[model samples]
Target: MQNSPKKEFRNDEALLDIQDRPTFFHWLILSIQHLFTMFGATVLVPLLIGINPSIALFSSGVGTLTYILCTKAKIPAYLGSSFAFVTTMQALMKADGYPAVAQGAISAGLVYVVVSLVISRFGSNWVDRVLPPVVVGPIIIVIGLSLATTAASDAMLNNNHYDLKYFAVAIFTLLITIIFNLYLKGFPSMIPVLLGIICGYLLAVMVGIVDLQSVAAAKWFSLPAFDVMFVNYHFKWYPAAIIGMAPIAFVTMTEHMGHIMVLNKLTKRNFFKDPGLHRTLFGDGLSSVIAGFVGGPPTTSYGENIGVLAMTKVHSVWVLGGAALFAIIFSFVGKISALIHSIPTPVIGGISFLLFGMIASNGLRILVDNHVNYELKRNLVITSVILVIGIGGAYLQLGHFQLTSIALATVFGIILNLILPQKARSEK
Candidate 1:
């Protein structure tokens, strides 16, 4: 009798075979691309919530490095600033009535630590069994839809009437990104995000929207004003942070599993069976916790870098390590970073359109993976209600801490999914 077929791989080692690494040039090229992919995201957290960019960069670089080390560089992924925590941090600051919310935000990092421990000990599957698709999906959808304010503002930058140039830039940049990511080819296929930004920057320059004088004035080397770890504790802020940011991890946890599955498919090895998913997730959670401590924002599993791997077909971990090293170097060179910061608004907006939309799509993807059919009365009601309430700002106040429509909806979905009968799945 024929033996059961063994999974074929690109190499016998696939990802595990890191003994033969990418050449220096290969590392350099991949690092450059990785930097571009992660660059905007790293700076994005601080930029949105009024934190120092330099420190954010430094923290992101360090956090990403930590994740790489924890995972033993088994996965070819890039960790970036997570937007999920931005609102939580802002809410913490406002709720605390503190000078800066960074202190309480620091405390929130401990939540990630606790979560990592749970995942590492018991396993990551429970995260989903508890959160479920109904809850995690809609909450993710709301997070994306909630960005409409900024998305619209980005499009406004393209037009001067009422100075909506910001919004216009965003729309234009987004369009280019979609076209490239979905259709463009050759070198353009790999760096679609970068290309969109370049095009938008040029357009903005044509319209005199760019201010290079600031970039020119920025020194070659200088520490960012606020780029260190400091802790602040507000009991009220802690709960808000946990409620708002923790639920989002439900989606990311699944994403981490999916990524590991993909890496398994690519390498033809079961990662979870050996070094393990729990270990990787522990790294992911710790990476975010570290970033928050240094005011960098939360870190998350990145699908974009995965796309790069698919495009380039280069499975060398050295490339990922190279990217981190480059980011560390850039953290100190104020001038080079200043140039990156000089890129125009429209480009960012354009890229954000696709990036943000893809994020929303990921949430929906989770539901699809679960075969989430709304035929069941419970599923139908929970899903429909969540969509409307979260998108419509269905929120509740819990004393000093206000629960966002998304967070409230998340909790409600979890409870409903728990009690709901799965018998309906077989009905149709």
Candidate 2:
């Protein structure tokens, strides 16, 4: 049997890690690579939630910068629009409109800040102890699987009718993306997503599925409308909105932990111990609060960018800083923003099919890599329960607020892990 990856480090470590000092040009190129890696996901959130894509891009850049500064430039993670808040954002928008939703997002962010304080006081070992592989693996799985239907639904335009045009586009995009990722070499292979998108978009344009009017009508340069929070600011607190959104933070916090854990494994460094989880959580929370105030979606440390780091093996904080700068620049350029919005849904669906599935794959990889024995009944029971609860969209209501399946499953996993027999846990 393979040894647990939790105790293993890379045999061949990068001579020049993210902290290594590099030339300006080298850092710039690496940063741009990181930006391209996260570009698709950064914009997808706003597109789904009826927010301006420019605002999301801008907020991501600023939020990421905020994260970098908060962690004292020790961690190299990018803050991007979070998909976990989609359902709640939509519901809050319908209930009290976008303004209340924004405030609620800020409230949700404060939850992270509160949790960070708690961790700082008690240390991160408590957290890891409560959420071991048996618990976290299933939560990560649920995060990806819960979004599967949404990805497919968006690709098919949520219509009951199945259009071959979209199906063809999705298939072509997915196939080409996989092909490029596996067969290509050098820089071309590094950016399969950008290439796949271009191919799918060209096909979409030729098939008359794309609308060019938006791109043509958009100005060459203009300031993004920050109206979601600034112009639409109405500060009367809504208990339901705040209560509804805040609890979801607990759900995404697990995701934050997963991101840190994966990076630690990939880089063969204990970031959770070095920079500490408290500081990372503070950065993440601050980014979300800033995003809320700026009319952007809640931001989280992007898993896509983590994949980029593993592939490239260049781990410089400056690289993330450079990517954040480019994202900010993209937000100010109106034509660029419009161009992003003009990409066909089918094209995105093709990529989402791959991206979301990879997330689930990574979750399972966590179990296998860690040598987590499914043969143990305790491990099997915990994983099975969390997956069924989260994937099945089970909910628990607290007054006007509804805790999502992810949130419920997360709470249950932590509770189960704590209460399960110590002897059974140790024997496994």
Candidate 3:
């Protein structure tokens, strides 16, 4: 249960370690910073998928708390709505409504739980063998690239017609986000997406595109819409929806590993060995299960909040817990939810432009970081097939079940990786 020795900070020392308790004032400020860091991306998922943003906020708060408790308050990580499931959720919502989406998400969570149990009994080595960088990197790429058309459509079109005004707003927002990300310093630099949205909203307001009626009519305090599972809708399992969604758990699990590695480097604690991957995965799975039941998207560990930890050098779990509390509090404020809902399509599209591209880039980064040799025919063939199938919109349908896009690509990539022959040392 003990972690490895802490690595010494080379430059400025960490202001707060994982176990360090910050004073009330410092804790509040630090916690609020983490909240802001996660807010933009967290809410964006539910917004795009036509769900109540407030519920997403509430679910994320609860999910983070669950993760913290499950990890023994040792790892300072925040869970938020995952982007990996966005396109799948959107399609499911369109085809079978939110109930199908909820069932799919719950099924995905169960997949995580089962995998965690197996890892607890055996080990995580099988994870790498089944989902090596060669397979995983392209799957991640497909997730982002497959969403490209959606981002573009939202950015440039209004009701299926290309609108110059909407396109202009999208471009402006994209520029603002890029500038803030590249040139800003310290805390402000960490929240380029939030800043970009705020600026975009103001521009929309000026152009008379944003309607204020909903925000004005919203109450100051109210409960988020919990129209999920057995709340407002009957629970029904769709095999098609489960097939489309459950495999995504594997992709996000790899992402979870990456985030854990990043935190280990930044905080100098061996979380994988201490709290253990099994515990973290279980927490994430349980959180998503709760989110599905309560009407929200699947949750995963956020890299944005991790950036805050690396920047401020504050790794206190208490600070993250406080942030979770803030998110929960924000969700009940009716005006806030209304305001988030009022965000124009162009603004969301603009943010997605950058965010989705960054996701694809991270996929490339995995390949680069792992040094997956493209010179090998096996590597080339796997990568090429995944890209073509994923981006070309190839799918398999049987009766009521269907597999398409990222999910299909992921399955193909894994099978290919398992069967492909490895190059010998002499081949080099």
Candidate 4:
């Protein structure tokens, strides 16, 4: 009986060891590679939602640092704005202007603060119970499929025959990316998305599908975009902002819980109770709030980055610390943005097709991994409504205000999931 306290003490010490783990060069290298992997996704959100790419870069850089501090530098998670918020942000910007909407989103960030507090005070298990794999899984799938439509539009951003040519480019790059990721060996294999991007650009340039003039015109040390904050602020669209950004709190919150759950599974420390979901939520919310202030989209703890951490087998928080430094360093440089933007639309178009689809697949994977069977009528209806609203319906407009299909779909998903009846939990 006297040994009980000693045993608990040893376990506590070991947990501390995991949190205070040291870093080495290999960890740094791994972190750098991971950074590159997320670069596209990182910039994609700001670009998609009309936020300045350069400002997005800066915000993401700072936001990452904020995330680390908030989580006490535990877990190798990287923070970036999510594309899920794209439609809502764009709509808010277009209709209500930017000020009121910005306030509304800032208010929405406060929602995250509340959520963080709840998770901290009670337990994260409640969040998990409310949004089980069954609910979140299909929603992820819808997000991916829904964005595919936008990818098609972007295929046009750099080319007119976007439908025909980009469809081909997208298919080719996607298959290449999948093959490399699944079968390729070694470090080169680790960045299949990057490889697909390189190949896609080459193919596009060779066929004259991509314009090369921008590459030369792009200055080596041009000033990064950090201005234009007040203009967006003055544009009051509070109603639209509230309606549009509020619901996304649900998406980001659910995603955050899932990442925290993953860290718990990986660290085997049950962080859901220790540093706790509340701490993690504050980190995530604070990170996004910072991103918004700097004219960037809201950030979230990335599940993909978690996969990278698992693969690297190096959980040194310092790895992310290095990555944060790297992002910050790049944020101030203008040439980086020009180079990324100049990479040819066909290349981005192709990569977007793959990355976006993978995002959707992850959502689908969530449902499958958790064994959320949909043979029952209730499950079927919940999924059907989410898909139609997310994937089938077009944008809706009321006078000056417009509600995007994606945002609408998300709202629809949350409602249906909450209301849907539960079938008996099957065997794991």
Q: Please give each candidate's TM-score.
A: 0.71, 0.84, 0.74, 0.71
Q: Model 1, residue 308: what's the lDDT?
A: 52
What are the per-residue Cα lDDT tens digits for candidate 4 across 1-428? 01123333133422122334333544455556556656767888766666677677677778788877877775567887676566667767676554544555565577788888876667667655555656566666665677676666656554454356665666677677668777876545545655776777677676666656775676666555553456534543456577667666765665566556555544445666666778777877777666666567777766556655443334556666667777777666656555555555545556566656656766676677678777776678777777777778565565434455655665566677777566634511
Q: Pick the candidate with the highest TM-score.
A: 2
Q: lDDT by residue for model 2 over 107-194, one digit each (tens)?
A: 8899999999998998888766887878877877787788787668657762666678887888898899889878987546545776
Decoy 2 TM-score against native: 0.84
Worst 10 residues of 1 by lDDT: 1-10
The lowest-lDDT stretch of 10 consecutive residues in candidate 4 is 1-10
Consecutive 10-residue window with the lowest summed lDDT within model 3 = 1-10
Off by over 4 Å in 1: 1-34, 37-41, 47-50, 74-77, 81-106, 131-144, 157-168, 225-281, 292-322, 363-370, 396-402, 423-428
Clash pairs detected, candidate 3: none
- In candidate 2 the C-alpha lDDT for residue 19 amounts to 58
Model 3 stretches with alpha carbons more than 4 Å out: 1-53, 72-108, 225-275, 292-323, 398-404, 424-428
Better of 3 and 4 by lDDT: 3
Candidate 3 structure quality by residue, lDDT tens digits, 155-258 = 99988999998999999998998898788876565456668878998998998888799999999999887976776865566987888888778767766775
Clashes of each: 25, 2, 0, 4
Candidate 4, pairs of clashing residues: 98-235, 99-233, 99-235, 100-236
